[model samples]
Target: MKDHPLEQVRGNPSRPLQTIRQLAIDPEMCMYALTMSTAESKNIKEAMADSAWIEAMQEELHQFDRLQ
Candidate 1:
């Protein structure tokens, strides 16, 4: 019979939950979706001062360049 994939890695069912949790949170295999903030900046100065907003802007510009 063919062995289950998880069983092949873990060898036993003693810590299935832990194994699953480790796989779910593994950095090398997992990438989180980028999230945008709902908060609005009053002006350019305010938006530019916030690092998160700056990063979001850079990512948007990168997408434009990548598609073109």
Candidate 2:
């Protein structure tokens, strides 16, 4: 079994939720962007819209899907 990205975030809960938000938010987001845009909103709206990721998050992360 592979480790989930959110699991890594759970390691240091003090780091803030925005950090964890980045992984599922924008897989392609750069390192510098994460730091620079830390204050800015990290929108997972696009990712949440993706059916595959949403299902994976539900099955793997146990987040329920109420979008339908």
Candidate 3:
């Protein structure tokens, strides 16, 4: 789950929605997807509040793990 060291991730608080979506759906952006914690970041809760976003995240997770 560790991100590729050569890859750089940037977050844009100015666009909370977009950032949250990316965080949840784009596992590559995170150095360790399974280790990424939401306890310190409420953005995920805010994003998952929308059912559509939740579903999207689920789909992406499967894709990332090749367990779909």
lDDT of 2 at 64: 44
Task: Report residue 58 deviation for candidate 3 (angstroms).
Answer: 0.5
lDDT of 3 at 56: 74
- What lDDT tens digits, residue by residue, belong to model 2 across residues 1-68? 13345432423445544555665566654454556444332478866655555666778654345433
Candidate 3, 1-68: lDDT as tens digits:
13423222334334434455676677665544445433233587777665556777898998989963
Clash totals for all candidate models: 0, 0, 1
For model 1, what is the error of residue 27's alpha carbon versus the real structure, in angstroms, after optimal superposition? 31
Candidate 3 — worst ten consecutive residues by lDDT sum?
A: 1-10
* Per-residue error (Å), model 2, residue 35: 25
Clashes of 3: 1
TM-score of each: 0.45, 0.26, 0.32
- Candidate 1: where are CA atoms >4 Å away? 1-37
Please write out the lDDT profile of model 1 over residues 1-68, one tens digit for every residue: 13545422323345444333565576543232111224567899988877677999999999999999
| Winner of 1 and 2 under lDDT | 1
Compared with the true structure, all predictions reach lDDT values of 0.57, 0.50, 0.53
**Top TM-score hit:** 1
Q: Candidate 3: lDDT over CA atoms? A: 0.53
Error of 3 at 40 (Å): 19
lDDT of 3 at 24: 65
